[model samples]
Target chain A: MERLWNTHIIEVGFDKIVEFFYRMSEVADKLRQEGLYFRYGPERLPEIIRIPERGTLRVKYGFPIFQKYGVCMDVTNVEQALIAEEAGATSVMVLDKLPYDVRSSGGIARMASINRIREVMDNVTIPVMAKVRIGHYMEARILEALGIDMIDESEVLTPADEERHINKWLFKVPFVNGARNLGEALRRIYEGASMIRTKGEAGTGNVAEAVKHMRTLMNEVMVLTFMSPEDRMKKAREYGVPYELVDLVSHLRRLPVVNFAAGGIATPADAALMMWLGADGVFVGSGIFKSQDPHIRAEAIVLATSMWWSPDIVLEAQSMIDEAKSMMGIDIRKLKPEELLQVRGV
Target chain B: MKVGILAYQGGVDEHRYMVVEACKELSISCEVVNVVEKHSASNIDALIIPGGESTTILKLMKRFGVDEVIRKSIENGLPVMGTCAGAILLAKRVKDLKTGRVLQGTLETLDMLVIRNFYGRQRESFEIDLDIQVLGEKPFRGIFIRSPAIVEVGQGVEVMARYGESYVLVRQGKVFASTFHPELSGDTRLHKYFIEFVKR
Candidate 1:
């Protein structure tokens, strides 16, 4: 019955996080203020948790993972996750969009890709994640069935058979969505998306202005309907809420949904800003990959992520982090890595 | 400020958003209020009852407190806007949604044929361009979310707006009503129109 349900947008009064929580809790006893929505504490974004030099222990409130020196990485390979861990990433977002026909390739199919992700999960002690598309609830459920931590419910990609494919709210799995604006983001949360990532207007390398725009918009909307920032955080904390994507979805009751911010994060300062703007964690992509000092920047990101949430403990890494050397050395023309080509946005 | 939106409980978000958006676009402060609240009438500068389950709204509003405040507000000339269930509330004689008893509420404010739940069920919700006579310019893109139809208009009632065969929008003094949700109708011209009417 839940699979084919499509919701027509309706306007209600101010989004009532508490009222919604109460209503939903009344319906589902397990959620009785249980708030089984987000991964709390410092281990939230375990992808970058193991960065060797950049791993700091600073923590921020509300975001999924804002530690003193938070560590996170985007990886197609397990080894890269290790490197990110060594550099200081708590969690690694696995973003190799599996080929539409994984069976066509002898190496691995999309389903098998999850197996490989599982291997990475096995190798790492921290939480790991993979991406899925809207309406692809089956694959997402299967991913959750395999015990992979969180699924990035990406909007940019979908092999959905039809628009009638309902939201993942019906499933027992945790779902996340990447949204550029607040209204839609909150809607996704209500629909059972556990995680929320910043849309970041992908493909465009421009970061500063776009990220700031997102933060400003969210700030206004959140403040308009709910308690002040400090009070909201305290309440969320009192409820044992992570105020992360997964938590917001589980707590959906016409309230301000909590989610980690992602996309267009290009600097440690940007990572810091996401925390400042109420993000639970930061997904650093172009910022880490395109930095002049890749290793240093990556380390800086991990450090900044952790410290951004805390007033104390600024990043002062002792070990020399590898600045991601110019990728010009890797002969992209020589090697036929289609994944790299996709990143080129050609 | 405790802005009462008729939680007709069918599809409330659209109307809630329209008013919120209008206030946002116009920089006026507002919030969705329960018309059922006893305190809402005196507390709010205005009221909007969105398009929704008329039977549910009528019964619930009365069970709650919307019926009283509405009459009190109209008597005091406080601005009250009804779209669909809201429109029904402004009617002098509403066919008691359940018993079909044509009972009278305080509303003799507008002259119009008010039909209850004219747009059948949920499957009938639709969208169409409306030529709102009051705007005197561009048409209002009416997004009818389970809308009722205004079957007729009385003499004093200015047929301010219509979509094809149905009177989608209308107004009367401090009491403005529409069969379709003008608040949900994407265009702020109606909200702006209400604001202008209220201000004047």
Candidate 2:
């Protein structure tokens, strides 16, 4: 009797399934007439299949939704974090050692101490971010447990796993990853990175790599926008990212998430240049703490980033800083390929 | 109609897109401007303060000498909507959620007391469907990112919506403020309501 009832239900459900598909196609046609089909295209149906709960989706997208633009200062200690916050920095990246120090002391670099990060969080009202080694899922877990605002699966620190990065989708707190070009950026996004930053050479105080990465990413995005659907799919395959993400980028003409310039940005002019080149914001690693006067320099960088469109305000910001006090920059050409930080994480 | 968004930092582009889209839906011809300076602030029909770090926006506004101009403009009956950090800026008093200390240098345009980061940190940020009656029967999704909470409202202020115990949306005369980001939700009802408010 139970078997007969189950078979009867299946037979009846089959026609309902067919009817459902028929109605869905009809709805799709109407949406196409309204020019909204591409936004909810069939190719994006897989994303719907993998959708998390509504609450989780909200937390996942909230990082970029409320991301504070302008200057994101990298600070090594509690005092530096406090100063950065007071100087109007949108956020501060907590580090166990400044990039320059990490370069000077050659050893295995790991996440910052929990106590120090806690102290910084206690001292400042602004958002606090911390870094974890590339592919270091354990460190990411630890940071998430500590209730850090954001995590950077950073290449500046040593890579914990050379083959794979931490699956960002598993974590609730948003993760930011570094990318040198559009392909790398889309790949990181596919891995659930909520934000992307240029993988410029860190601890060098040189903006050339930062400029090159930004230009390369922007130019690739522009090229993608002009590509045919078939070519975009081919590009997506080449990028090893989802086709829908590539298609979305082609339509939107920009990264799906906020893209900030990071690594070796120093001085007010450099920050402004990155902004002019289309960075959503900037991250100054060793620039502030290594400068002659960190407090004034931090404020100046914030000013330049906020008012990059106005040359007079940028000039005033530049005048506030003494050029002689700037960090001694390293020539990128002098560094061996093995010593370069940007080449670490895929 | 011309609308200006405080464009120094944060989600300026998001707000601009929402306003433009709302205007198009309403069939209202609109000019959207970035209110970066005094001249831009004073010439706009309505002003929007986009969500960011309130301290950062306040500091830059004061630095560029536009803070006072914006305050006076709103005082003179300029319809304004403040979201998230923008809402914090319009409060009469702002207190740190953790320290319970008062934050100084806000615009003090609205008669309310707000607690900054009242919902906790970014990890605590959320999105939920809210029943905003002023927006009609359809529920509006509220995206609260490190959002503040209105702890107290003055006699003149009307509470329009709430999340649990605290008020999330409030309006007094021509000034409207919401502790959550309506721009990020991809909904234009609140923007349409603001446009109508400006029209009136």
Local accuracy by lDDT, each model:
0.51, 0.82
Q: List the residue pairs that clash in candidate 2.
A: none
* Each candidate's DockQ: 0.02, 0.37
Q: Per-residue lDDT tens digits of candidate 2, residues B1-200?
A: 99999988888877887888889899999999889888888889999998988878989999878989988888799999999989998999999888577879888989999999898887777667788998887778777788899989999999999988899999998899999888776678899999988988
TM for candidate 1 is 0.41
Question: Cα miss at A308, model 2 (Å)?
Answer: 0.7
State the displacement of the C-alpha of residue B183, model 2, in Å, after optimal TM-score superposition: 0.3
Backbone clashes, candidate 2: 0
Model 1, C-alpha of B125: deviation from truth (Å) = 43
Candidate 1 lDDT over residue span A44-109, tens digit each: 122222221111111001112111124446666677666665564656666563221121233422
Q: Worst 10-residue stretch by lDDT in candidate 2 chain B?
A: B121-130
